[model samples]
Target: MHPRLIAPGALAAASVLLAIPASAASVSPGAPGIGDPYYPAYGNGGYDVSHYDLRLKYQPATDALEGTATILARTTQDLSRFDLDFLLDVDEVRVNGARAAFAASGEHELEITPRTPLAQGTAVTVVVRYHGIPSSKQAYGFTSWHRTPDGGVGANEPEAAWWWFPGNDHPRDKATFDVSVQVPDGTQALSNGTLQSTVSRLGWTRYSWRSDKPQATYLATLAVGRFDLTTGTTESGIPVVNAYSKDLGAQAGAARASIERTGEIADWLSGYFGPYPFNALGGYVPNTTTGYALETQTRPYYSPRQFANGSNTSVVVHELAHQWYGDLVSVAGWKDIWINEGFARYAQWLWSEHEGEGTAQELADYAYASRPADDPFWTVRPGDPGPENQFHIAVYDRGALALQALRNEIGDDAFFTVLKGWPQRYAHGNATVADFRGYAEEVSGASLGTLFDTWLFQPSKPTASAARTVSLVPAEAAPARPRSWQRIAATNGVHEH
Candidate 1:
């Protein structure tokens, strides 16, 4: 997801408190959240989901969504009850083929008490029937369910599924998904992974898409509308599917121009982040008013505004690099967002080098000097920015700065090794910021504690001499350098995701 903001200096912060844990036996209720320090109520505990079989029907005309979600999971503890993060009005819930009592506990949680206690390590299947206008549902003051002209889209960062489907909504609970959305015959339903079937019957069409690899729930997406889908394969034979809403008007051309290069960009990114991690490669431009682009697993989501200026492969690179950093290896907690944003933004810098627009060193130096020492950009500690500042520009740019600093401190050989090997080591799993730093240190045999502290943890800008000493570039303030992150900041028209 795009950080979207140039955080102001007055963006107040006093402190930031920042996991998932299971319970023991005793037939107790599952914890309301999956133990994330930043969001205590984000995900549910006591069970790990393996897959989600979502059979949905969406009516764009009414902005109504009706669905039955079949969740297959394993109980982590003996449980008298469990919770699913959801918001829609549920008609009924069944656990293990028996009727289960359920109710809405909060804005986004559905508390379910099964007819029988679930035993630890036992496989369980939960079926939920629900109906609602997803766009009408809001939590935490916003809605990720976007009501488009012809259809609605379910896509956002940190939290998305609550408005569309129900499950353990946090990134820590990665699961494969089979999403079958039945829409009116004239419209198309698009989602993650390979298209299993496009079956039409009696004025209704069902689009079945499946993600073979485990994916974070937020990364699972939905788009139901009239679309111009471009399908093919990458240079390395990975399947690619690009979608542009027919209503995109002027931005359609630019969106296509950038999104069509998904295959080519994935090919380029594979060199640095190891082989392409997923079964498919592509993105979608859905004429959304959200004003941001999100790295939604195999197919990233792009706002029409992202291409409002022209074809921007830098944004494309930013999202595609996330195929490795964010989608493949998700953060252990929300506080570890740098593992996603910083790593992907750094990929944009690499693309600048590849395109001869600017070198990474030049961009890093430019980014460092673009902000004065007292700018809130420096105040946002990328390592553990509070929830409010999690998606600040500093998390993206300063996070990339931390990576470049690591590269310089550890030297090119070890840095590149760490870059290629980090995802492979934690592929399809959750990792933290400290985990990444440790991996870099393990590869470089260099104690980088102070360097990370200065760049990521410290709330003040490092001295200009550090830049000169590391990347051999004079850290002059605001030179007439090549187009750098200041340009990206201008182009990154994202909402408060």
Candidate 2:
């Protein structure tokens, strides 16, 4: 399972071009919605997903998978039925270990209809078995395994988990994850949080990982190869494990330094935002050609090409920031993704401050000068990150700019106060931009309507107009860069509120 939040463009562009073996599973009980099918709106609050047991045999030679999955979930609402969305490749399913029906109405989702009424807080377990060549495409969620130029294997499944398993495949449905994968004898496997154990049976190795925190569907990850593994503990007792590829040479002290720094950052964030939400914190530096890193729960997956060298502190800070912003407090849906990227990006800026680097102003000024004035928060259209721009720039960079603006409007103490409070208030849950804005207004004791409107709602930067009329004292000289007598009008094509 490769769980990463995907941009809408990538999600919209997928099709069944690659060949997939057809399955003869029983006909589904009913049809599901054409749009993201897995995350159904359960009216009553508090969803409890108890456990997930996946039985799969993975063949790396041809990238084929034969597996059975049993999932148990509970809801606080008194409901007669429940439905789940999984990848379309599933061949058979049983609710509570009995033959149950399912339907594939969407590209990446299989609608699961249970046979019996599931009452409030009633535990449910689903068993599924099937076989197919899981798609390598990111569109339908489940991405099959692929090896890099080095022998190490890495996979990414953002917005789509259907390439591997079956479930409610959306970020909103927070659940505890339990995975068991059967791989070849020599290969090692790594995933989201911590490894429980590895049992050897015949030529297959079943690796188990369990996450105690509430995790979104897209944050699940899997890496497999002849990995060189090392284990250590942080100063605060969090486990630190490293998975290095054989072709990547020996692990160095710098890796440990970064991990220690990760612990420090986590402590700082915990005090500021909330406690470390998960049981473990670690990740592997996979050999890759891409520069972007995937923050997969406690163990974030970093690419060696980007993070191994000391030059990629921003990337490291960005992913580490996600542990609180994106992982602990998540976006309710795809449209509000800025809450994830924006907060994480600002966390990087705060780290820069802690490191005694350039002030937040210098960072914002540099970012503002680099991007064109026409576009602000990356969306020419809703769900479009930007016109040919990675969500990083629009979502992360400009999103950071928005927080800087808020910081300027509110004093430093109150600003930090809001930052530290949000993750705990919304942990294991979902939030919107409005939710944050309300929280900020409550903490800051000021109106942020004009600031949020100029920075967030509009795709244009605020123009800092010089104070036209300056009052100079006749006797005493004014301090250098004195405060402006009048507020400057920001006319960057946005009507000021």
TM-score of each: 0.93, 0.76
Question: Worst 10-residue stretch by lDDT in candidate 1?
Answer: 13-22
Residue by residue across 1-497, what tens digits does model 1's lDDT show? 87777455434331221011233337799999999999999999999999999999998799889999999999998999999999999999999999999989876889999998888999999999999999888998999999899999999988888999999999999999999999998899999999999999999999999999999999999998999989999989999999999999999898889899889999999999999998888899997887888889899999998887888888989998989998999999999999999988899889988988788888887788768888877889999999989888889889999999999998999999999999998999999989998999899999999999999999888887776666655444454576655556654444356
* Global lDDT of each candidate: 0.89, 0.61
Candidate 2 deviant stretches above 4 angstroms:
1-50, 75-83, 113-122, 135-146, 149-157, 249-261, 307-311, 375-392, 466-497
| Candidate No. with top TM-score | 1
Model 2 per-residue lDDT tens digits across residues 1-497: 98999887765655332332232122222223313322332111323455556666776666667777777776555443445555436678776676667775545555555675445555667787877665453443434344554332334434435556666656666778877788899877777677899999889899998887888766777666666777877667888776765665433344444544566667776766767777788767655544446667888766554434444455556677788887888876555667777777677666666676655655565555545556544343222243233243456666777787777778779988888888888988988778888999999989888777766666455554310111122213222321210101010101000
User: Top lDDT: which candidate number?
Assistant: 1
Q: Where is model 1 more than 4 Å wrong at Cα?
A: 1-25, 475-478, 484-486, 493-495
Clash counts per candidate, in order, are 2, 11
Score residue 2 of candidate 2 by CA lDDT: 85
Quality of model 1 by C-alpha lDDT: 0.89
Return the lDDT, model 2, position 138: 49
